[model samples]
Target: MGITLVLMLIFIDSVSTFSISALTDSRNSTTEKEGKNADIIRSLLNQETIIRMALQQNVHILRKDLVTIQEKLTDVETKMSRNQVECTSAMSKLESRLLILIDENAALTNAIRSDLENCNENQLMSSMEIQQINQTLAGFDLKQDVAFTVGIAEFNKTWNSGTLVYNKIISNIGNGYNANTGVFTAPFGGTYVFYIAAVEYEKQDLGLDIVLNNKSKVRLIGNNQAAYQTGTNMVVLSLGKGDEVWVKRSYGKGFHSHGVPLTTFTGFLIKHV
Candidate 1:
């Protein structure tokens, strides 16, 4: 019986040791699993922190860019407002100056118009005075400076006793003498002096008369057979306008020498009435 008890005790001891060992192994496995769980949790926490920091940095950069854009917009608005105010002020000043210039121009135009009116009145008064002066001088011989002198251009072989012609003209201030018809028509009522000269050189006697409206006024005679002889005469006449006067050959065949224009007729108005 004691031997049986000893054997049973040994078996009990062996069963106890095996149960303790199983308990120790279970504890160690539980501890290892806990440690692995702790390491996985730490890794997840680090990743979350890195993502949050990156989001914060990006948000800060966006805010700074927004501030810069807002500042630029404000500055542009301020400049535009100032420029608008300046332009309005300049336009107002320009309009005021333009109004002043227009007023001044109108005043100058009025002054010029008034001066022209005064000048026209003075001109009218001067013209009336001139007319009165001209009328007063009309009756008193206004010194009519009328004159003419003519000569024969060529010497003819003989001249018939009708009218003598002076073909060459030295001066004809009044245009009263006609070279083609050899006549002088009085241009105005005047007192005139006349001179006539004649030369005879072809052994002939030459007689010339100053005729007034077909009436004889004076005579000039030259007679020479051996040398040239000249006869001259002068007369003063009071002639009416339209009276005709000329020189004529007196009643015979005559030879008159001319070429230095020696045979000449001259007349002048001494007084005009």
Candidate 2:
């Protein structure tokens, strides 16, 4: 009986040791599976963090580009606005200049008409006088009367806000004109007829007067608000021997005479006194 009891105790001790060994192996397998799962989860978290950082960087670059584009657009708009204002101002000035030109053209047309009428009257009167003289002097020897005349088509000179002189001569008869001094010195006292035509450059107001012996006789004005303008004047005067006649400009204004025949002065002795 003592031998049987000792064998049973040894068998119980062997079974307890087997059971503890199995439990320890199962615990070790569970710990290894948990570690592998934790490693996989950490890798996935790292990939997610990298993707988030890349996305944030792209968004920041996009924002900066948008700001730059906005600034460029603003600059372009400002330049366009300035150009528009300048264009509008230029158009306004052009319109004003056109209007002034129209008015000046109208004035010139009227003056031309008046001058034509006067010329026609003078021609008719001359024709009538010639006819009368022919009829009165039929079959009679007639002596020609002494006559003097001078004319200039262009001045080709410059004058500054004072007396003007015509230096160009077209026709001089009876040796009565001095082109160097711009004077018509009457050889004898007579009834004299004088006429003047003038043109000026753009944007200039030309105020001129026909001066007889240093006295203003008739005034002529050529307005230069247009591209160019013309003016004319006519006068009849009774003068003594050696009388002087010339042209003078108004005060505080300049006059320009192009090389062309844009200005003229003419005088003739109609009859001796």
Candidate 3:
């Protein structure tokens, strides 16, 4: 019985040792699985962190681009506003200048119109005066020849050499003498007697001539002397209708008209041709 008890005790000791070895092997396997899981989780966390950083950098760049675009828009708006103001000012100035030009053009037009009116009035007056002269000339009776006498009224005046003396009208009968032109137009074909008289100042020469159709008919001359002198000339002329006659200085010498009717030209119809 002692041998059997010793053998049972040895068998119990071997069974305990086998159980302990099995438990230790199970714990080692559990620890290895946990370490592998932890390593996988850490790698997932690192990938998440890299993704977040990339997203943050993109957002920052986008914000900077937005600010730049906004500033450019503001600058463009400012330039547009300034251009608008300048354009408005220029337009206003141009309008004002146009208005002034319009006013000036109106004034010039008015002045031209006024000048034309005055010119027309002057022309009308000249026409009326000519008409009156024609009427006066037409009033003469052409049935018979008549006589007329005319003289220069300019006294103590120096007449230039070679110039006709024609300034005033003393008398015009039979509508023969034209004061403006210093000419006598024959009223009818007739034999006429013409006479001319002239007086000069002291120490001055005087000359007178009767001209018919630009032909010298008669001449009277007075030389310069110590005293004033008078000259007279007479001529008989046969004139036709529309014949012209006048008195002129024959020589290029100065003459002075006395302060009287001393310078006289007379013509009378003797008989009709």
Best by TM-score: 1
Per-candidate local distance difference test? 0.80, 0.71, 0.73
In model 3, what is the error at residue 244, expressed in angstroms?
A: 1.0
Q: Estimate each model's TM-score.
A: 0.46, 0.45, 0.44
**Which tens-of-lDDT digit does each residue in 1-273 have in candidate 3?**
999999999889888888899888899889999999999989989998998998899899999999999999999999999999999999999999999999999998987776566546545754664576446446544454567777666555466444355555565668788777778889989877787766666557777778999899889875654334556677778999899998887753554564456577777776777
> Any runs in candidate 2 off by more than 4 Å, and if so which?
1-158, 256-260
What TM-score would candidate 1 get against the native?
A: 0.46
Query: Residue-wise lDDT of candidate 2 within 1-273, one digit each (tens)?
Result: 899999999889889998999999999999999999999999999999999999999999999999999999999999999999999999999999999999999999987786566556545754664576456445333332333333344332345555565666666777677777778888889777777766665546777788899899998776644434566676778989999888777632544455556577777766677
Residue 66 CA error for candidate 3 (Å)? 99
lDDT of 1 by residue, 141-167 (tens): 646578899998677656776778788
User: Residue 81 in model 3: shift from native, Å?
Assistant: 99
Comparing 1 with 3 on TM-score, the higher-scoring candidate is 1
Candidate 1 ranges beyond 4 A from true positions = 1-144
